[model samples]
Every structure is written in C-alpha cells, then in structure tokens.
Target: MDGDVENAPLTDEQVSDQWKRLADLINKLQARTDTKDEFNARPGSSLTGDDAWSPPFHVSHAVNACIVAGADHLHACKTLVVDAHSLHVAAPASLIRGSLENMAAAFWMLHPTSRAERVTRCLRWQMVNAKNARRALAPLDLKDPASYDERIATILEVAQRHPEIDIAAVKRGFTSTAAVTYADEHSGAALGVLLPWQLCSGFAHGFTWANLAFSERVEIPTADPDVFSVRFSTDLTRALYLVWAATNLTESVLKLHAQRSTPQY
Candidate 1:
C-alpha cells in the first residue's frame, strides 16, 4: 500500500502539502454544497436532481487521493511500509463522494451497460492504486533493491490479520435506534469506516473524524429506539454514510478500536 505512491519521486514535504491542500479543498467544497434533507431524503426525493448529487463523489475521490498521496508522503518521509491499504482510509471526512461519482462516470463512459457495477469497480481499483502508490514511495532501512512482491505480501498479511470490526454491536451500544437499514453491495471490495453519529444528526454540523479502516459492514437492525441503517459498497476507497443514526456512534467505534488494539502479542 505504502509503496505505490512512494516511488513517484515527489518529496515527502511536497506530498504532505499536496494532501493538505486536497483536504482543504474537499472541506470547502463540502461546505459550499452542504448535504441537505433533500439530499438525504428518499432516493427519488432529490430535489436538486442527479446533477446536484455528483459533488459527494468528487469530495470522496479527492479525500481518497489525499490518503493515497498522504500514505506516499508517509512512506517517503519515514521509509516505513505502512498498511495504508487496509480499512483505515475510507472515512467520510477523508473520502470525496464526488471522486467516486466521477470515477464511476468515467468507467461507464467506456462500457455503458456496466455502469452500476463500474462505479464500485473503479472505486475499488482507485483504492488499490492508491495503496500501490503508497507502497512505491515507501523507503527501506537498507538501500537495497526493494521487493514489490514482498511488500505486497506483507500488506496482504496485515489486512487479513487486522482486528475484527463489529458494526452492529457498536451501533447498538451507542445509539438508541430501533432499526437501521443495512444495505451492502458485495459486488466489489468496499472499505468500511465508523462515523461520529452526531455529525449527521447535529444541526449545521457536518463531517467528523472517521475511523476509516474497518473490516466489514455490520448493522444493528434489531436495536431499539434509534434506527440504524448501514450502507456499504464494493469500492473499498469509497465512503458510506451512516445514512441514519439516532445518536453518536463515534464512542462505540473508539471503544471497539481500542479493544482490538490491545495486544495479545
């Protein structure tokens, strides 16, 4: 993951600056076209229509780019092959929805029939490419020829062994929802993240620091009081909204991450 971007020949500081600029752009863009009730309304209820909804994907892609670029910068700066490929970079705040939409649009532009599937596919590929870029930029302790295969193997191992995530349990513990939608698109590899529920429910509050990397999507369909709907896509680099949550689920995610981080090794 770290190696892909590292080999780009860009300086660490330059890469970092790029990420910062990208992040800022995404933030401002989000602010300009805020997600309104209309946007969040039922699928057919988008008053702004299809064209207006495209911005989210753009924001998502830019943020993912930052992660990819940022990972490269990290590798270049630290010479460490971090597992940037895993479920740690798909946060709402980090992923630009507009990017996802744009990627999908471009993909379908080539093979129109596969448009729906292409959306997720392109996103997943972008994620892998970003990871590759990071891996490329990764620096090693010894100035010897770096083995791409070896680094990929390490990343795969890290992804496979990453701590398990339980979205259902966590959401239930934190929110007061009776039921939530658990939409999952298994067509492609989707990156999952835990979000701060308050951001969605809070008036004027927007995005929050998302727990970008999570193994999969688990919903609390049976939770009482608050209804939780968990939407997931195959695009590992794409962002999925809590869509709906009665309370802040950020604490639950934090606890989950903390518990998993506890070393048995």
Candidate 2:
C-alpha cells in the first residue's frame, strides 16, 4: 500500500513546484472574505439569519484573518525561493513564525471563554500601539503643536473607552512565546509547532545559535600579493522549513473554517 511505503526525499524542482502550488492556494484563499453575506450566498447554503456575534462567526473571522496573513507570508517565501541565491532565510522564517503564531492564537481564541480574553488582549495591543504612535508623534508636535492633536486625541479616546490594561501583564501575555504556549494548551498542533517557533524566534531575535546555523565561510582571492575576502552564505533549509510550515498552517486554518461553516444538521 502507498501508506506502507516510505516517502522519497523531494528534489529541488519538486520543492519549487510545491512552493508555486502553495502560492496559488494562498492567492485563491486571500480573495475570500468572512462576512455572513459571502457565506450565505454560497451554493446549497442554508444560513438564513445573521450569526454575526456567535462563536462560530467570530472564529471564522479570526481564521480568515489568519489565512490572509499566512498567504502573505507564503507569497514572500515563494519569492525568496525563486531567488534562492540571494535568499535571506531569517527574513521569511520570521514571517512564517508570525503566521504560525497568528494561527495558534486563532485556534486558542475559538473557545467560548478565550473569545473574551482575546478581546481584552486586542484592546491591550491597541493601547500599546496607540502609546507608541503618540510617542513617535511627540517630536513632530514641537514643529507644529496642532500637527498631531487629532491623532493624540484619538489615542486618548481609545484609552478612555477601554478599561486600562496592565501594561506589564499585557506585555507578558502577548509575547510570541506566550502565544505558542496558549496554542500548546488549546491547539492540537502546538507540540509540532513549538520547536519551529523557538528556532524562528532565535533567528528573528538574532541569537548567536541561530546565526551560526546559517553562517558559511567562503574565501575570495584578491589580485594583490596577499589579500583575501571571506563571506558567509546562508543555508536555505530554514527558509524551506518555514515555507512548508506556513503552507500546512494555511491548509489547517482553511479546513477549520470549512468545518465551522458547515451546517450542523
């Protein structure tokens, strides 16, 4: 049986083809939206009234966002694959890590209780963004005091509207590591995702261990009596792993959405 046979290793051409196929799938998925209108309009659909605030609706929306984000990262990886000679493995690996983290969060948020916590975390995130934007505009405001008044006002409004987020707590909760842990607790794929997350996180953070993995020594001969140039060539394995993981995560998100959308008759 085919299942009994061990799989052969993929050749370079086969890997390239897989990348192209993944890119195509991402493009198709990105064209879709998560609104009720789109879902109810599908052929043989039975959705009648709006379930906008329901758990399934919210879950579907989060999954759709995850799909779009995953597609973007997949496309980026595809571009890097096409230009393998100049590939910077860390760049796409970082993006892939981000996409996976988002997927994990989406899955984690699918539960009834987690949905409210997700909202709180979102508000906390927005608060951080607003604070950062205000700080960035602080200097510009010196040139024209009114230049960023509206922007500052908007940030303040958000802060006033939402219950104050404990900045330290929020920081602790929203880290990539924390997201992965949440996934491990809620999403079944966490065990598979943890190591990759750690590997990519090291790269993204410029850890010595991660950098060493990509480093290669190359010597360039000089015309002068005794001069030489040495440079490092990055291994493409990280990038390949990133692309593969992204494709799998995208497919998982799509399947989750499909299962959620199906009528429970």
Candidate 3:
C-alpha cells in the first residue's frame, strides 16, 4: 500500500478548485467601497467615541491590505508551468508562507470582541510597520525624532487613550507565527494550518530538516567515502496540502472581513 501510494499520481481536481475559490475571494476586494462604508453614519458604531473617527474603516483598511498583499503572493504562484519545473519546491512554499502570514495577520487584527481590542491590534501592526519604515530611512535624525518616530509616538498615544488596552503590556512587534497558529485553530479547516505554515517556512528558508521531509529522495550509501548520494523530487501531496491550508485561511479572512465591514442595518 505504501509503495503504491508513493507511486500514485498527485492529480486532483480539488486543488484547482481551491485556487479558483481564492481568485474569487480576491475579486471581492474590489467591491468594497473606499469613501462610503456606512460605518460612521450608523449609530452605536462609534467605537472610538469620536464621531470624526472611524475605527472600523481605519482598522479594516490595514487588515484588508494584508488580504490584498496575500493575494499578490498567492497569484504569483501560477498553476501553469512549463519545461523543467524542478526548482518549484521552494518557490510555491515561499509564496504560500507569505499568504499564510497575511491571512493570519488580518484575521488576528480583526478577530476581537471589543472594538478597542481590534483597534489596539491594528495599532500594534502599524507600529511595527512604522518602525520598519523608520529603519529604512537612512541618516535618520537622531537629535530629534523623525516623522516615522512621530507616527509611532502618535500611535502609542492613541494606544494609551483606550482604557481596555494596556500599552505597557503589549509588545512592540506583532508575531506572525503565533497569529498563524491562532487563526488556524479558529479557522475550522479540515487539515492543520500551523504545521503546513511552519513546514513552508522551514522549506523556504533552506532548512536541512525540511529538505528531506518535503521532497522525495532516493539515496545511495557509500561505505568507502562515508557519504551518501541522494536525489530529491517534488512531493505533490504535500504541495496540495499547502494549497488546501492557504485556501481555508484566505477564505476565512474574506468571510470575516465581509461580516465585519457590513453594517447591521
């Protein structure tokens, strides 16, 4: 059974269908309105307690951007391939790893009961991005904080305004791996998400353990040289599992955003 299973072809219609579903999810991003979301006009929707501010839109924008970024990474993973695609092992996994992170971050940012909690998560996510941007700005004025520093400072001030959140307790940077694990646990996916995500991370980063685990290998043991010659090939089953996990995670993000963005009325 094991030999036959190993030799069996990896052709399946389900993987193709999942890709189509992901494409559909990406299309929904366009339907969302930028100017008019009815969030501000709706009563009792003011989580910030200021009629001028729209927490839903402010928070959703970053979260949705994550979805869009994830879509780009996933789209780069073209199903169509020609010629020698042997180097495909690391590429798709790398792309899916990105997709997983985006989906997880979006889910984590929006997956809170209180609007303050959601806003705090968004602030943290943006704080990390701002700090990264500040680093990229070379020769940053050390004597006086630059605009990026001011931006982060403003975010910290905002974080302190909410009584529900403790700024001192929160970390400066968001952890994508923990977010991915949390998202997968709540995603209701048939297959495990964190394992696939970690496997992808490992494979994408050129980790030796992932190399043997993800690829098909035929080895020749040499006693004289105390060495072994090995050949590695693509493992389609594992590839399909990655696709399955991405599909579920992306779908969950889209669904959650749709539900959260729409007004109760």
Candidate 4:
C-alpha cells in the first residue's frame, strides 16, 4: 500500500483517501489527553535528592516549548494532508524541522551539563536582546529619541541585575554545534533526526532541487495547464515516520519530566 502511494501517480480520489488515512492516524495519536495534560503540568524539580522537585524557570520553559512544538507539528501535518499542494507542503516540512530541532535542544537540556550550557545560552540571548535594544535607540529624526532612551534604560537596568552573566564567556560556551554534538554523543539519534531536517530545510529555503517536485515530463506536448495535472501524492511511509518521531520525542520529554518530578527514596 505504501509502495503504491510512493511509486504510482495517484488519482485525485486516491490522494483524498490517503489523506484521510493520515488524518485518522494523527487523530488517534492526539487522543491521548492524559499524556498531553501531564506534559503541560508543572514539572517537578529534583529526581533523587531529599530536596523537593521544583523545576527551574528554564526547565519549565523548555518543556512548554516542546509541548507547543509537538502540537504545531501535528497541526502542520494535518494542514498539509488536506492541502497537498507542492508550495503548501513546504510549510509543514519547515515546521517539522523546527519541531525536531526544539526536541533535540530539550533532550540535551535535560542533562546537568547541557542544562548549565543552556543557562549560559539564555544569558547570551538576553545580552543579544540588550544589544538590539541599544541599536533601536539610535537617533532618527522621524522617531522620538526620548522614547527609545526610556526603553534602553529599562533593558540596561535588567541587565545590571545579572552582573554575574559574563557575556563573552556565555557567548563562547553556548554554541548550538556543541549542543547537537552533545546530543549525538548521548542520545545517538541526532543524525537520524537531522537528516530529515536538512531535506525539509531545502524545501523551506526554495532551493532549485526542492522545486523539482513540481516538474513533470510529458511525451505529448500540451498547451492546457490541466493537460498535465500535478496533484501531490501522499507518502504514507514518510507521514508515519514523522508521526513516530514526534511521538517518540514527546514520550522522551514526558519521561524526563516525570523522572525529575519524583524524589528517590
């Protein structure tokens, strides 16, 4: 069935039927309301110590982002299933890539060392925001310079409170390359996740190769656009793989949160 979908040029009816199957599978997976609830719940702090588990602000934020990404991926998949246009499908491919990347980051942050790295990254992120705020404060004749000054002051005040965050050190330590490398070393799924990510990125960036999806060769030349109708065919195997990957990442994140929530006896 999967081979037929991938190899044969499907009719409009076949395309609709395949889309229905894909939508049904997504719906079935999404029906696990309890899991989704647990995912959204406030995560506990520590896993094994006498101290009560209280998730830090960053940990909570990461979990929230992961959950949101999962939902976004599902939504994108559903949208593409219905639309099935070459241009429209690129949006979901891009979304899935982003979701996978976020999952990878969350996985790395679950570890102690990686968590520290993430903290440094957060500090650097704040620094970048401050820098941008400063740039916005640049005097412009049309814009009110005083208003920019007030915003810049507010940002600077916040920055002063975190005097311990060495911007240079944080910049040096918080690299995405290092994070992905760490994930690869530990989880062993980095490459598998990244391969699809790269492929999707090609489509997102509007590369020539990606545009080949819209190309069709016909033995008989036809002037009518409808003569060679190009309806996007659903790749069941790819859809199933995406669903499985999203579910796996979701489970891993939830398990991590649960592990941290429970204290060791």
lDDT accuracy of residue 123 in candidate 2: 38
Predicted structure with the largest TM-score when compared to the true one: 3
TM-score of 1: 0.19
Residue-level lDDT of model 2, residues 103-135, one tens digit each, is 665454443233334444443333444456657
lDDT of each: 0.28, 0.52, 0.65, 0.49
Give the range of the ten consecutive residues with the poorest summed lDDT in model 3: 1-10
In model 4, the Cα lDDT at residue 119 comes to 45
TM-score of each model, paired residue for residue: 0.19, 0.59, 0.77, 0.54
Worst 10 residues of 1 by lDDT: 178-187
lDDT of 4 at 15: 57
- Candidates by lDDT, descending order: 3, 2, 4, 1
Q: Mind giving the per-residue lDDT tens digits that candidate 1 earns over 1-265?
A: 1112234455656554544544343343334234342112122321112212223332123323333332232222121111243333233322223222222222221221232322232233333544555565556433333554454344334233313322222222211111111101211212211122222222113322222233245464745658866543222212122211100121222222233223323
Predicted structure 1: clash tally: 51
Best by lDDT: 3
Query: How many steric overlaps does candidate 2 have?
Result: 0
Report the C-alpha lDDT of model 3 over 92-135, residue by residue, as the tens digit. 78988998899889888777767767777777787788777878
Worst ten in a row by lDDT for model 2: 41-50
Model 2 misses residue 118 by how many Å? 5.5
